[model samples]
Each structure stands twice: as structure tokens, then as C-alpha cells.
Target: MGTDKPLIGFIGTGVMGKSMAQNLMDSGYSIAVFTRTKDKAQELLDKGAVWKESVAELANSADIIITIVGYPTDVESVYFNEGGIIENARQGTYVIDMTTSKPKLAVEIFEKAKARGISALDAPVSGGDIGAKSGKLAIMVGGEQQAFHEVKPIFNVLGENIILQGDAGAGQHTKLANQITIATNMIGVCEAIAYARKTGLNPSRVLDSITTGAAGSFSLSKLAPRMLEGDFAPGFYVKHFIKDMTIALESAEEMGLSTPGLSLSLELYQELAEKGEEDSGTQALIKLFD
Candidate 1:
């Protein structure tokens, strides 16, 4: 809070948020962090991030707030509740929600924040844990143009592919579209390796042949290797992926759009989650094939 740069309040120090907050601290910005679990903030505290005991405390202390919490319900609780960001943050503060949540909720936050003179942007991210650490995540933002420009430098520190898609809930809509693509892609990646192993070819050899070809994808190039090496750790969790797919599917149905691929993939991911792989990395979806 005593820094020349605007103090950054980082909420939700999870798998990706931890690395992202650390990167900001590493870039010399003072960070105030709060999560439901204090221990999760320890690594960042060791690296010079100041710890706050609650969302309201952090909200009042920082000029810019960034949150990447789990679930739409969590997002609502932090932004709309009595002692939350909307009530506690100073006038003219910038609040960025990087959580993949409901588009309607994003619009509500934007309208409410605007009335209270706070700038709120729904800026959901992609590229997983690796990108968060490397600062290469693709950020899809939606808010007023002026507000987006004001936060672009901060966005630059957190991601490479940053774009202000439109207004209010547009970022969330874009993220749902991203989830739809990834849901189908994960299935294809799983089946490719499964087919290769069943037909007596080296899965890695098959990957080498196809990774740079027409079949190339992030799941193929990055996650396939993780699957082969049996690393089911949460780069991105199966539960979260299923959450995204569910949001995408609901949005599609609302628009009278048909997404058979998204529907099937959601079914597969739901099956994977029900099998007790919810906390595992989405790459573990391949286990369904096995």
C-alpha cells in the first residue's frame, strides 16, 4: 500500500492466481492478497506480497483489485455482498474480475460499479497455469473503452493476448466460446492417444507426426505429453472445465443455438467428474478412454 505504483489487491490465490500475483510482485508492484484459505497466500507473502485478512480489507487498501475466484456464486459474493468490493473500495478504484462466470452477472457488476464511480471490467483469462506463470495468458475483457485503456498497462503485466471485446458481459461470452472449443478439443486429444496406443504405435511418435500438422492444438502439444507422463496434476482442474462447459452449453441454448460437440463433451467431462477425477487436471479426461 505504500508503493509509488498503485497497490494491487489480488484475491483468490489458487493454481493460476498464485503465479499471476507473484508475477506482479516480481514486476515490483506492491500486492495485497486475501483468499478464504490463508495458507494459500503464504508463498506470495514469502515473496513480499502483503496479506489481508478479508476481501473488504484488501478492497479498501488497493487502487486496483483483481480476482480469479471459483464459481459464479463466489464472484457474486465478493462483488455484491455488504462488505465486498463494491461497498468497500474507494471511488475511482478499478476492479477486474478474471473469474470465468456468468455474463449476466458481469453486466450487473458493471452497471452497479459505474453508478458508484468504480470501474469494473469482466476480464476472463485463458492459457491455464503455464501461461499465468509465463504471463502469456490470453485476456478477454469487456467494459467501457476508457476503463479498459486505464487498465491496459496492468493487463500487459498479466497477459499477452489482451483484447477488449465489447461492453459489460462480452468478455464472459467470449470465454464461454473458448470453453466450447476446448471441450471438443480435449476429447479429440484423448481419442488420438487412445487410438495410437491401441493400434500399436508409439503415442509420442504419433504426437510428433501430428502436433505441427492440421491436427495441432494446445491440448495436443501441451496436455498430451502430460497425459503420457501420467501427470494429472491440476494445470486446470476437471471441475472447473466442466463448469465452463456447463456455462457455455446454457448460453448456447439460451440463444437458440445448437452445439452438439459442446453437449457431448460436457457429457464426457461430467462423467469424468463423477468418476472422482474432478480435482485432477483436465488432461486426466484421457482416463475415460483407458
Candidate 2:
């Protein structure tokens, strides 16, 4: 930890979290990391991040805390648990949860943190692993305008496209909207490639033509190539996508919104998960068409 730069405590060094934490470390921030699986965080540890055995220890010592854990339940456990962030984090510490979680949970965290004199933000992100490694992620933040501005420098280090969406849970709502877009776009990308293969068009060349056209999308431009090469390794896991879509669907139902496309996408992904493809990448949706 440095005297000038705030001591940043990062919990969860999974696929995207590791890269995001590394980018911050490479940019010269002193980081303290805590993860359930220490082996998952060893790379960052070797790169000089201080390791804390638990979130409580990390929370007590660090000036700022950032988490990108697995799910909404994990988010709740980390922040509201007996030995969690709220209980141990120092006054005025800024805690940011980058997990794509329920909007209401984000709001609950914000209100609780505010009462305790801790600053909290729900700043869920998009752009996946590539964006995390390149620091080009699109970050949507929800919190007080003042806290958002205060954290802008940190956000700038992790992402190029950053926005203060609104207050408390607004960032999460915006991220849910993002997940909805990706869910349907992924299905379209898979169907287009399947069509291309059936017609004997070289999928790569087809991509070159269509990916820059009106049909272009992140899934089409990025994941389609991986699919073509039969690479189903996870950049963003299908299981996580299922979680995001489930949350989005539940949120929609709560508001009495009709989301036929989202509903259908959810069903297909759930089916894929049942086929034991849940751990595979979102690009693996192409397998469903076959």
C-alpha cells in the first residue's frame, strides 16, 4: 500500500476480475485481494497484491473496496454477512459491486452503506474479458453523483466508456438492459452462422461481410470467430448468462413487462445448460442450432 494512492481491496479474481485487477495494478495502484479460492488469485498475488484470508480482513485495512463476485447471493453474503464489508470496512470507504446482480439488492447495499457512513455504488459492467483486459469496458454506475465523480478516476483506469446512469440501483437496471440485448443478439449470431454453413458459404467470409453491416454486434464480431474454430472456452460463461437472463426475466415480470424475445432466449439457454453446456462460453450457443 502507498501513502498517496488509496489501498484498493479487490474480492473475486475470476475471468474478468483478474484482468481488471491486473490493469489497476499495472497502472500502479496498491491492491489487496481476497477470494474464496486462493489459487484463483495466486497470479495477482505473485504480481504483488497483498492477500487477505477473508473479506473482513481486507475490508478493515483497505481504503477502497471493489467486488466482482459470482451472483446476487454472493454479493449479499459479502456485503451483509457478519464478517462482511459493512461490518468491517472503515468509515468513508467506497465499496463498488461490479457484479451483474438484482437492482433491488444494489439499492439495499447503497442505503445500508450510506447509513453507516460508507459510500457504495452498483457499477455493473459490459464488454466481457476482452474489454476487461484492454480496459475498454463500458461501465454503468449507480450511486450519488458526488461518489460517481469521486470514483471517476478509478473507473477511467478500468474502462473507456463509463456513465453515471442514475442513483442507487440504476446501474444494475441498465446492466439488466445490457444483458437483455446480448441474450437476443447471441441467438441471432448463432442462427446466422448456422444459415451460412447450411448454404455452403465460408462462415469467415460471411462474417466479414455481415459483421460490419446492419447485422453487426459484439457476439457476431467477436464470439462468432471462436465458434467457427470450435472454441467453446468461456470468456463469459453460459451459466453466468443464464443467471443474468433469469434475473432480467424476473425483473421484467415484476414490472408486468412483456419480453417475448428475452423469455425465448432464456428458455434456449436453459436447455443448453441442461445439456451440460453451462460452463461453456456464450459463443457455444452456436451448438444449439446444430
Query: For every candidate structure, what is the RMSD over all alpha carbons to the true structure, in angstroms?
Result: 1.5, 1.4
lDDT of 2 by residue, 62-154 (tens): 988999999999999999999999999999899999999999999999999999999999999999899999999999999999888887888
What are the lDDT scores of the predictions, listed in order?
Answer: 0.93, 0.94
Query: Positional deviation of 5 in candidate 2, in angstroms?
Result: 1.2
- Residue pairs in candidate 1 whose N, alpha carbon or C atoms collide under 3 angstroms: none
Residue by residue across 163-185, what tens digits does model 1's lDDT show? 99999999999999998989899
Model 1, residue 177: C-alpha shift (Å)? 0.7
Clashing pairs in 2: none
TM-score of each: 0.98, 0.98
